[model samples]
Target: MPVWQTIYSELSQYNFSVFSIMEDKNIEDARPWIEKSGAKFPCTIDTNHIISDLYNMFNVPTVVWIDENGKIVRPNDVVVMNEGGAKLVKVDPETYIEKIRRWVINNDPPMNSNDDFIKYKQQREHTDNEQVARAEFLIGQWLYNNGELELATQHFETATELSPADVMIQRGTMSMRGMDPMKDYGPIAGNIIKKGLRLYRPIRD
Candidate 1:
């Protein structure tokens, strides 16, 4: 978030726009954090995970680059923020920043296209299981909003079981149970690690 702030500050002079979506958070729940961040750019909430489904986002902090033609140049990826932020994942912030600059200047060069983007899009083509998981997740969100914790938990658990690879469902369920989905070192991490899963699975092109 700090890194995004820095980028926003730096690039505000250019023809750049930056916005963020807080998946799994309602507008009320997200307001305090948004205000605390002092973000100038517009931020929106995704209480129903609609954007997640559309974008095929399974994790938080995923970035997608869109061109002037409204075409996706870059699919979702774990964007390393600043040096301190990158330390958590052992990525060089400078390298990531350089790539961003190149993309900005070159406008997503054709030669630099990533195959993973296509692969991820295809994978997100929504199998029957995925549709069921999505339905369960939406129902869980509705139940949570209506103050039905037990019922919501049941639906969320079903969603997680149906879509084990989707961190959005898993973390959304955790957040409802008063857990810190992003920061807290919790069982979700252990479960994914035990299954030999990449925490930030790259979106295939």
Candidate 2:
């Protein structure tokens, strides 16, 4: 987040700003990082993973580049924020930053052509099961919030089954199931990998 703050600070003069969302079950879990980052740009907590559902985002640090006119220049893609994060996610943070810099400074779209963008969006469009998973997740979240843990867990489990690759649905419900997400992420990630699925799929340049 500090890295994001730096990027925002450097690019704001060019009319580039960031609206970061942290996908945590509660604000208190996200508040420390938010306060520590001291980010001037808008930072909010997605306690119910609303942004994830809206953008078809499955992973953390997913970026959706939008222009001044609010058009999506780039859809949801993994953007590891820092060097340590790059190592964990196995992506070059510098490359992601360079893309952002080029886009912000030169007004370049990340894709080479509209055809490419359209094809990419079509390929990554939200599936019917994913839509249903979002609804299930919402019901689960409400149940969990209202002290119906067992019933909530059932819905969460159903949601994960519906969207097996959606980390926001899988890992996001860990705390409700009495698991530490950070500590238990390895098994979940391993499962995704064993199934020949990628957790981080970035837009090609």
Candidate 3:
């Protein structure tokens, strides 16, 4: 809902309104932050998570910009950060602000969807493994927050099983493996083997 938040933040000049938050699922937990962030805007809760999941938001802070008929002009990653446009490569706060201004005013996206980005988006939809990875990460986050370091490792291990290549899962796994240099490289060999098998084995196999 960053788009809506931005729009509402400038409603006096732009006359835009935030229609909904559309958060369904375990997001009921984030209500305090939502209220604090959206003190002036209208917000509602969704228990089913239908819209968020349909758009493949495995986590918080996802959004879509829909036209009147509900066509998506922009899908995922549409919300530009209000961080005052920093330079993408070497962005200062002023540069970030300028970027944010450009994003809010421009009708077209700064860049077209490239082949790699399209493939990444497709990866989110095409792989059940990714969803499973999300579940693992969520569980791991819960475990970590609850002071269950040993228990959290199990969830992270499940995430690695789900999406061995998922960066978030990899990062979490790395954090848990901190200071253990030998363990650090263990997954790399397994990853190489997995990649090799995928390359050499027939698709049917």
Best by TM-score: 2
lDDT tens digits, residue span 56-173, model 2: 8988878888888998888887767666877866768788788789889997777679998888888888899999999999999999999999999999999988888888888889
Per-model TM-score versus the true fold: 0.84, 0.94, 0.44
Model 3 CA deviation exceeding 4 Å by range: 1-6, 9-32, 42-53, 58-62, 78-124, 137-149, 164-205
lDDT of 1 by residue, 90-203 (tens): 656676666666667655552244665566667557667767888998988889889998898898888878877778888767878677876763678778778876567543
Q: Considering TM-score, which of the candidate structures 1 and 2 is the better prediction for this target?
A: 2
Ranking by TM-score: 2, 1, 3
Residue 137 displacement (Å), model 2: 0.9
Q: Which regions of candidate 2 are displaced past 4 Å?
A: none
Query: Which rank order by lDDT, best down to worst?
Result: 2, 1, 3
Best by lDDT: 2
Clashing pairs in 2: none
TM-score of 1: 0.84
Score residue 145 of candidate 1 by CA lDDT. 83
